[model samples]
Target: MLVSFRLPLLNEEMDINDAAGIQALLEQLRSSQAWQEAVALPTAPNEPNIVPEPEESNSAPSASVAELLSQLRTEPDTSTLDRPSEPTPSLPKPTTPATPHLTPLTPTAPTADLSDLSRHLTFQQALPVIANLSGNPNLIQTLKSVRVLLTCLLELMFPSQMKDEQHALETRLMEERKAIVTKYEEKVKVAKTKASMIGSGMSKHEASMLSGAFHKELKSFDTERVLTAWDGLVSQQQDALSQLGIPIMFASTEPSHRESQQKVIQVLEGLL
Candidate 1:
């Protein structure tokens, strides 16, 4: 800071050459209560306007606050309607978190009789495992990223040997899925029992309120969980479709016939 506090015949004098000078000036300012009080005083009416000097403020849009408000009112916000009232229940602990970088898309867990490993071949069983894996994600991914993951998934699932291996992969995935479900069931049971424990201690009014709240929350929780599961399944199907070009008009087996079919089938089979 450069300052000439003294009102002279012509000009006053003060300038800080470096940080040390600035620090010393600050210390002096802090120590002098009168200086502090003077600094705190409101600016003189005769002083120039202190509007912030935004480098490009003049070049930008200068909509008045009222106009900006009117513009805001013109656009409808759909995000509010799309938000869920409550989140899904916490499921069991997963072994490894899914990644946006999963080189080949695959379900982490199978959806079929995963418990019956013997019912299907190992390769066939892997599809669901890959799908389940694909579903798990950190806080970073969006719906679009999930879609991109499907491309890698398509390539992995639609291999030439898919039919031979699909069932086995499916079986393995089902087994892992059963384990996850069992773990989550146990957690839900614990939460339920804990929830019940709070019931016996309340007055009638409290009981009624708590009961209603829990009922509502539980319903929401269940719906959220079910929807999440359904979404994961649907995502798998969507990924399959994205790879196969819809109806898979490219099959060699018939006019069944013209292109991305085999890859699409491989992708869906892996999800099973």
Candidate 2:
């Protein structure tokens, strides 16, 4: 840069041949630099010039977030400005109806005759009666067995025609059975007594008599006779039941009804 000034000075200020002129040019350059050090200079043309903004002004500056919030709090809302206010809809109230008076109904009795003899009875109808008569589920099975034997007997003999003869025969048989049992007990006791007496030194005749009487009494209570009598009475009752068309439940001879019959028999036994 000093060379640029030196070239112009060489061309116009002084003669390069004179040494006195060269010394004078250097002295002028130093003086100019010294004067510049004593005085302030403006910014260079290449640099930006900045000036401080004034703190106080008439026009408002852009607001900070805090200032904007406070301004909003102090100001009235403009969002709903010029808009009309609407009325809320009124809802209708519900109305309840008055309660009505009700009449109580009475139960009516059945019109059918329950005891009509001509009514055809099924097992369902008869079972209850049978259960009632038997009074025990076990007895139902025994009654069924007796009925079965009686039915077989009825196939070979004539049935009774007397009114309620079946019930009468049953009652008579039960009484006879009781009597037989009592008589058997008495016979057993007498036989035991007579044998005991014979060992206590009875005469030959008395001994023979006691032995003969004991054997005779023992033979008198014939099991087969008792059974035959019972069978006869049952046959007559069976005839009566057949005459009435009463069904014997679980009495089917078919193997298909076997399980049902067993179940019915069991149930009857329980009822009895």
Candidate 3:
């Protein structure tokens, strides 16, 4: 078919030069099955291995001329014959995984430990201590015991020039102490004098008769008992107060364990 068309173009001098005839010939060339079938490409190597049935496949171009003519005479089996064997579709290409935006580890400050202990004074209040000190003029032993405890508390709470203030406070304390002790001492002394009057230069009957009006107040929890208890109690209390004030590091940051320190607060408050 190609040889037949080229023969006319090749013989230029004997060319079919009428424009109408040439246009008709070109239109006929476009509608020709021979031209349409000229590009009968082979099945690709990657084609499916399925051997299609006779119904599914077209007859090869090498088929008999009669069968080819028969196929052309009929309307095409459009469903099977119209579409291309190979189809190309545009698709979005998959992209490379973008660099994982590594978030920089933020360095954090230590959390401020707002504990109950943190808000409290590291030592006892001053007024109650002063009032107790002022009352006991002759409470030499009690003051001595408490003074040692107070000295420790003061030194720990305020590392300032406490020694300077101690001298002045001690001087005044001693005067108050002496005056109180003396008052109690004189009262007891007068009581003794009246008791001594009972044992006058008279007989036993006269002493008994005079003693009828005499009376005495028995002591409550004694000074000795209080002092003994004070030693142990003071030591324990100081130890507790010291423990509460001290800062400690824990082994874990689990949320459940964070409130464990409140246990210490409860126990300390109970003791106080």
Candidate 4:
């Protein structure tokens, strides 16, 4: 036996495999106004529905607005607002007067006298006197003649007294000589004591070497010879005075007289 079966279909249902039918149905729904209104899509939540209002005609402001604007346009009382509560007192500044500048005057040097220079005075002290007398030849000659006369008179009147004064000067010179010798000898003794103390801490050879050098220095330290040399110089000066016929005793007498004699002697020697 052969049997055939047919599937049942609904009147409102469409076949899922029928593309043409579905497209035609969509076109019909789009064309129908009633269908479009009935099934309209909802607006998006982010999109606002704004309606523009109509513009009003040009006119003046209201009475209250006009009064408010007039009040704003009026000027404020700045004088009262800017003023301080109390007025401040101002003090005057003190001024200092300028002092006058003064120029100082130069001082003049004092004049020196020829009679003030002496043999007891140093070469430095006699320099001014010598300079003053240098130009006056007649005055110098007169001084020399006076000194010669005075010296002759002194020698004739007090020969014994002059000799005693000369002896005293020699004695003083000898005492100075002894003092110098004693000073140098004390220095040598001190050097020897220092060397001995230092040598205690040194090698024998080094100590001996130092001792030799120290003794050699002492040998060359002849203070006695220096005194003798000074004595020779004094002797030479005395011999020169004797040759010139001027007494050494005259130098120890009146300072003014000795000064004049010295000045005359210096002039004569310079001429020679």
Candidate 5:
């Protein structure tokens, strides 16, 4: 009887336990006559003598391969070849690196012209302009013009050091107004004190009488005299401005005079 055995080929994917079983199976076959015959088979005389050189395999096996060989050698069981192997846990997939976020730069605002700021200047703005122009010979005309304009505006607004007649008239009118207010205030205070002493019964009637007297005094107060004094003060300022060649029109209505003054200020500001 002819005996034949089929052997499976070993590959990298074969489990270490399975490889050990295959190695044991090969050992069993080594004692068989057919294995002995196959190993003793003679080569033809013309065929080259093939020899494996240790120097050709001088390079070491990779770590994975060495580790597989180690596992196979350590395992003693051959029956495990018939059993199913535990599945290997899969490795996580590599993630793409996140792109870095960048904040966009803000564009700068346009620079404003220095001269454009003069449009909204108050009377106090003159001081800085005067200080800057001082000691500069080339700006003498500008300095003089600004000084005169500022002086005119100040005199028109405050009206100090009036002519002898105008000053006396204003003083007299102010005194009269003060006297009227003082007299009424004194009377109201007396009436309030008396009512408080006499109790609430007569307080209402006293308050009504005081109120009437106060209103009568206020109505009698000469507002026309104060207006006349102001008009005289303005007339004096107009004369002063004319002497300085500022030529503010006192004869014009209040609104017209204000408009003219604004025009003059604009012209003076342009000179700077």
Candidate 6:
């Protein structure tokens, strides 16, 4: 097929009849200054070269090729394909307030008194008081009786300082002592009234029987009965005091126990 072209500048007609002629025409046009100027005509700053297809070809670049060229011109950002894209910005999550931890406190036990305990007046110092109160000149027996009295009184008054069983025992013994004293007092009153009736003309046989009954009652309700009960109570109390770790046997023992005992004694003394 023969392709004809009229050159505007040279005012000549050329025909490309074969491949050789087309090659020769391309070489001639590349060397010409006029062709060079037309080829160098700038279309856009950054764009692909778009040369028109030959008029002899029935297919004008396919739809795919045109679409591809359009995409290349529109979307020029292709450098990001090799490198990774920037991460999208994310919103920070809402923060929650922290709860505070609380600690519990322990309660302290009550402390004993000090100023009143400084007087140093306890059952140990009760020798003179005992001698005067009982009118007993025998020092040895009096001191022994004082200790027994002190032990019984200390446990009875300060049951809080003793063990549960010891405290219960002391409570029972004290209640028993109270009952004995009450019974003794009632018996004494009745005996005194009966003695008053002896001289009021009662029969001799009845008088003799009353006298024998009074003697028997007197023997039964004597100081020995109360003393026997107190002795037993003191023995138990001494054991209880030893179990409690209180060194009350001697005046020269642990001063802390003595001080605590003295504190309680001072309060009792004040009450007395």
Top of the candidates by TM-score = 5
| lDDT per residue as tens, model 3, 26-133 | 455445565345434455588764433323455353232224323333344577787777767768799998999999999885576443324332223323333353
The residue pairs that clash in candidate 6, if any, are none
* Candidate 3 runs further than 4 Å off: 1-223, 244-272
lDDT, ranked from best to worst:
5, 6, 2, 4, 1, 3
TM-score of each: 0.18, 0.22, 0.21, 0.20, 0.33, 0.24
Give candidate 4's total backbone clashes: 0
Task: Kindly give the stretch of ten consecutive residues in candidate 5 with the minimal lDDT sum.
Answer: 52-61
Off by over 4 Å in 2: 1-200, 203-220, 248-272
Best by lDDT: 5
Worst 10 residues of 3 by lDDT: 151-160
Write the residue-wise lDDT of candidate 2 on 10-117 in tens digits. 345333456676556544544554323322235458855432121232112112212322222323335666566676777877767777887887877667634333
Q: Tens digit of lDDT per residue, candidate 4, span 107-187?
A: 765565322224345545545555665566754443333322123222221133334454565567667556656665675
How do these models rank on TM-score, best leading? 5, 6, 2, 3, 4, 1
Tens digit of lDDT per residue, candidate 1, span 1-272?
Answer: 11223212112223324456445544543455433443444555897544322222231111221222232232333576677668778898877866667487676666564333322324345455445545544211222223222221333333223323444444555575566556555655665676679874335664565557655655664456533543344345443433432333121222222123444344544444
Off by over 4 Å in 6: 1-156, 160-200, 204-212, 250-272
The true-versus-predicted C-alpha distance at residue 232 of model 2, in Å, is: 0.4
Tens-place lDDT per residue, model 6, 3-104, is: 223334223333324456455644554455644444455556686665533233232232322332233233334686767878888888877867767667
Q: For each candidate in the order shown, give its overall lDDT on alpha carbons.
A: 0.40, 0.44, 0.39, 0.44, 0.49, 0.45
Candidate 5 residues lying further than 4 Å off, grouped into runs, are 1-174, 196-202, 205-209, 212-216, 219-222, 262-272
Candidate that beats the other on TM-score, 5 or 6, i.e. the better one = 5
Winner on TM-score (4 vs 6): 6
| Clashes within 3 Å, all models in order | 36, 8, 1, 0, 0, 0
